[model samples]
Target: LSTVHIESDNANNTLIAIGGDNVYLTFTPEEPLLLDSIVVTIAGLATTLTESNGSYTATLTLTGSEPDGILEFTIDFKDRAGNPGIQVTATTDESYVNHDIYPPEIEIISITSNNSDSTWAKVGDSVFVTFTASETLDNISITIAGVSSSYNELSVAKYQGYHVMDDSNDEGDIPFLITYTDLGGAIGPDADTTTNNTNVQFDKTVPEFSLTRMATNNVYGDSLAGIGSVDTLSFTISENQRDLNVELAGSQKTPEQEELNFITTHTFSESD
Candidate 1:
């Protein structure tokens, strides 16, 4: 002649406590429990709670890398003078999430003022962007100086909680137009949502360049010691290429056609 009952302190992931304290309730010495057990299930990362006498509680802290989800758990108490009965099976859930500080890389993957459509990202106008990239994404986004060009593109990626952008063009320096996208979704999307201005200032400085030689002649600066009128000396210096990338020139009917931007451009000859 007895009844059982159970209760949960937290319906979500929590530091569970009970009765001015906590109780991982159990039974012993005959008088079986109506509900004799409880299964503590949790998601994300959980640590066992320390027990004090019959009072205790536990904590489950979420990790920065924990994914979004839920953890279901059950509690069982037996029917006794203490009403060790599962009046209503106690239930709870734990949720996990990935806090990102940076947004996804809006790597102008493939942009061209070509068709009227521009993937929505306008040229001069600024706008916010968003994405769920994992962990707190803070710093991510590349600038093209508000200057538009075929060589410019946005690249967003997670190198180490950092949304990295490689605005590398084959040739010429593109004015850097930066729009920081941080902890929202992707890189730019996130930054757009949180920032006051969408697109900021542009890198106005035009890159410098010089002509070097790359040939097979030998007499002058050719790699071969003595084959042609070219010197056996090389004339290529490892350009700082810090912000430069390698690009191939596109074909055009006229020499005035737009030249593809690239970092390195070599000339061939046998002159002194």
Candidate 2:
């Protein structure tokens, strides 16, 4: 008996489900083979092989439960001289059939930005996105503000990419969506963005503010004041400012009071 060669009607690495799939095997005999003396078993399922066109061929339907890996098969036959022959090894040339029933599980690790403050982004800012999967994947992409971009593989099961902010983006909080396919030909669940996960905001308008001296203060803008006088200044801003600092007479002062209307006040006592 010669080496048995295995082939499948389904393509190599083709994902097999619970249903039946056909596999064919062929082998050469050293002498004339006996009729009804050929048997082939694959994954614990047995089938008979018949001689056809100078070759022994058999078709087996893989309907039984098999492990989630390469399929192994064995062949047994007898010659016309009553010599029994058994071949337990076969070559598939790496053309393997895989069985996988579970789909890929995907998770978005982070969606961030490279701006000075990760919470906000400007027109020239770059937003970074990262994700992971249960297995290696293909056709991976991330959609942000209606724009789609592909991801680069950083390592096995990890991917990273970035998108630059442009004028086409809206001036508000933006959401993201991700899609990918695993090696088992399963489509992963779409990762939808939420307020708690995504925090980048696009703001283009410059914040405005107006400064006014308190009416009860002894000093006003362009007004003469005596030595050692105390003055209070109020600032009304268009929006809330973080780390706001005010410099008066070469001294830095923080806001004494911050209000919902975006108003901040500072009091200072001057000398000399």
TM-score of each: 0.26, 0.74
Predictions in order: lDDT: 0.30, 0.66
The clash tally of candidate 2 reads 0
* Model 1 stretches with alpha carbons more than 4 Å out: 1-39, 44-47, 50-56, 61-68, 78-272
What local lDDT does model 1 show for residue 249? Answer: 26
Q: Among these predicted structures, which one has the highest TM-score?
A: 2
- TM-score of candidate 2 to 2 decimals: 0.74
Worst 10 residues of 1 by lDDT: 248-257
lDDT of 2 by residue, 165-227 (tens): 899888888677888766645567887664246678887767787665543335464344445
Q: What is the lDDT of residue 225 in candidate 2?
A: 44
